[model samples]
Target: MADTGLASERPLRSASFRWFLGGQSISLLGSAMSPVALAFAVLEATGSAAWLAAVTTAALVPMVAALLLGGGVADRHRRDSVLRLTSVGAGLTQAGVACVLLTHQHPAFLLPLCAFSGVFQGLTKPALRGIVANLAAGRGIQRASSLLASVRNTTKIIGPTTAGLLTASVGGGWAIAADAVSFLLAAVCFARMSLPDRPQRTADDPTMLGALREGWGYFSSQPWIWAVTLAFAVNNGFNLGVWQILGPVVANGTIGARGWGLVLSARGAGALLASVVMVKLTVRRPMGPALASMSLAAVPLILLGAGADTLWLAAASFVAGVATEFFTVVWETVNTTHIPERLLSRVGAHDEFWSFVPIPVSQLSTPFLAAAFGTASVAVLGGATAAVAMLLPLLVPALRRIEIHRQGE
Candidate 1:
């Protein structure tokens, strides 16, 4: 028998999946441009990286907190409604940024606005994932996740490169306004989505708090989840700190501003190719070990830092992108498939809150780390530590059994 890529017999579900992918593709594109636009605007106006630095730092709290609270709410409420409402809120927020830009408003407003966007995301991201899990169904989850990774990479390609050109030509204000318009388009897509009834808790279940607690227990019971979540939090925090502290200085001051844009775009291109390759993969449940393996592959952040050139950086960036997408897709798909849908968002929050907990601290401290160790050395250390963290987990037998076949067994 010939195997068509179509996992489901029903055409309607397939159409819905396409619609979901289309919306996300548009959303990812605009988002990719945002950091480039924001950073450039800050530098051009104040002639100081301080504004960009401060807002990036300020964003950490609201993002993690909002994500936590939003996850709690998402588990208790209808995920569809939550996503719809937040998408509108996010669009309106972008509109406000656009209005500031359209009026030729001060660049001073940009950082705080970016921070606000972080708050908006904290509320919506969990629900977004929960919705995808519902939409993907069991058989289609891997493909759906892969499609998401590809779209994300595609946006990475479009966003930064476009922002670079746009900022160079039109000015930062207008580029920001373009991002705002993308959010409105995202809202329209969210409205058109028709999702199935969210998997409901059985009638005997208690309050939302009780439900939340149960999710906590369930996640805690899994040692590997806890271990990996901790590793990511620390690794992500450390990496972000380095990126924020060093990337701008290198790309703008040392490497050249255009270099930063190209470096970012190259990584996205790499991830896109990786996502395409992974989509056709079929294996018995092995997300856990795959995750550990890919995490080690991140060792090149060291190479990326030490090399730092068009050719060197691009090659390193490509490998890093491929590794990141592989781990991320496996991580998300495993979570979506294994965790009960009713508790999906809350569980996601639990994972995110803990895992991403170090981001703010890391972002805040990077400048100091760079000042103390020097940018190149600091980046090299971060990369080394991250690579070590990924492989050390092999000592845990639970992580070795992470394939789908062993989940909850």
Candidate 2:
């Protein structure tokens, strides 16, 4: 295996990777800011949890629907081109959202705008994963994943706090505007990036539908992949749904928006710390540790359900961040290393599609569930469900036995 020290530095040596990382860093900063900004904007304007759920659900549903098409397009075309185009589209839609929010906080206008952005997001998601796999191929996928996670986590730390301050002082529209600018800047960076040449597709190449089916066949054939994806389908509905939709609502009553931002920032801080550790850490049996760490995701949800104070909530979020980041780096590395490069994007899309399918349901249902069962009860139940779901994949022998070997191993 490549020496841990050398492996960590190798991905950075590539100029293309550098550009990719730089663009993603700037873009993630804005994206990190966006949820906080958008959540508060919707909540403050509508003052209805259901409305907030509706607006957020609008974005997620289309993204989930578009994943397979986007994945096929990404695998067939130059991944960088897909990224650049999608970034531009997302930027434009986000700008429209900012403009509407600034002029009049209208849910009617926001729904379609957010849905458009989500389509761009669907197009962008698989391409983003494929590009990293391409850029960092044969040069420490784990390190590359860690670096990306580090930047993302770092931005989360800064973005939410900034969004909170902006939302509190100038209004959420400006913060959303900042996110739009970042997307444009990222598009510019993506345009300039150069990737290794992909094999030209031939007339014999499968049609998009055929290709998607093939991808699904491979994805479902892999017990490890399908099992984990299935688990996340259930887990995300609980973890992300509660955290994103109900989190702000709970905070609105208790910790306030600014405090909520801080709690998220604390989670970012923990993830950033984990990213640093992952750069040096080596795991032969990655799946076990990955899923084990993922179970920690339940902590903050449980805490939030219990109406923990700001300090306690932040602390729990921090721990969850660490766990989540560890899982992310391991998961990305395993996929990149094990999957064929040509099929990676489509497979990734399938993985993402299944994993995220439940998110919209969670977002749409949580508000009503909370209304009926009470937010705290729902949250605790969600956390318990997430914890159990995260561990169930461990029972799959293929997943438990999966191991990775670095270069020279």
Candidate 3:
């Protein structure tokens, strides 16, 4: 393992990081409601799986395009302002979706609005990373990232369930309104933040594309970065594309959409619990032992693979949520701390690309997988892939020895 100069204390001095995290937590809560409201709205209107998939694909398109470019821009600009712009744009887009649903009553209009939200979200990606890297710089990186991950998972606990109830009782229109309002609330929280300054750029700096190439170059040199990315890409397709989509669909039919919400909420609960404990439990800088333990945590797959009775399914989702949260918090924290900020976006993008690259593929392929192998079997295969794929990065010597380290203390 690379020498990380182990220190026992956290990085931040005041409660600012906590406040920052809370603001984001609010934003994520709203974001969590969005997919459910949008999905149900479209499904209610069109009743076509093909159209559902189409809208999903369209929504994500901007994310794939803008993420890399956004990272470069973040390096060049005031990350806080960039974040503010995106948050407002994202919120307005949600409001637009609500207005269209309530007033015009059109699925066609809603799709474009959702896509616009996705585009703004794409712009926020790099700024979010920059803020995280900055706030968590030094000792607190792991805990901060872990808390943030927990916050995101925590949103699933509240957002989806609330959306489901609103849709069930009031109509998708009201759920849309709540989501839009949530964004405004989230914007207020972000507006109050005071992040430290970004690294100043000289007048002769390279273009965004050139900066992108530089970022890519840094990542490519690290076998761990690319290898881990590829591995996650495989797992993500199965994890994000297959499990996320099919899990809810299956749960909705078997347990009820409300039940689906509970299952997802269970995941959030498990993640929330694990992160609370992990915040105090320092990482094993040497990857071998803890990585082995993280690998074993994948045992929940057996539970997830078999079709669930309502109770069993929720339990499995909760279990899987805890295990996945543990893995992600540890991995993300380590990655953020160890990689330099300039190169961080590329590394993040590298891992994220693989993590997300498969989503579209899996989303496209999942129906076929379900038809051929059965939903249970498809889920089983995805779980198995997630369980086994953790070893891919370990195969590279550099990653096995990678430890969380900030450049300057």
- Top TM-score model: 2
The segments of candidate 2 whose C-alpha lies over 4 angstroms from its true place after superposition are 1-9
Give the C-alpha lDDT of model 2. Answer: 0.88
- For model 3, how does the per-residue alpha-carbon lDDT over 137-163 read when each residue is reduced to its tens digit? 555676677668778887878988887
Ranking of all candidate structures by their lDDT, best first: 2, 1, 3
Candidate 1's TM-score: 0.89
Cα RMSD, model 3: 4.4
Per-residue accuracy of model 2 over 211-330 as CA lDDT, tens digit each: 999899999899999999999999998988878898999888777779999999999999999999998787999899889889998889998889889999999999999999999888
lDDT of each: 0.70, 0.88, 0.68
Q: Give the TM-score of candidate 2.
A: 0.97
lDDT of 1 by residue, 1-409 (tens): 0222353322224655666677777777887887787677666666655555766665667788787677778877766667667767666666676666657677667556656777888988788767666565555677778878889998997788788777767765666677777776776776666666545778886676776687788778887778777777767876755665567656666555466677778889888987887676745656555665556444545655675576677677777788787777777777877778777887888888887778777767776777778777877888777766766656668676666432123
Better candidate number, 2 or 3, judged by TM-score: 2
Q: Poorest 10 consecutive residues of model 2 by lDDT?
A: 1-10
Clashes of 3: 2
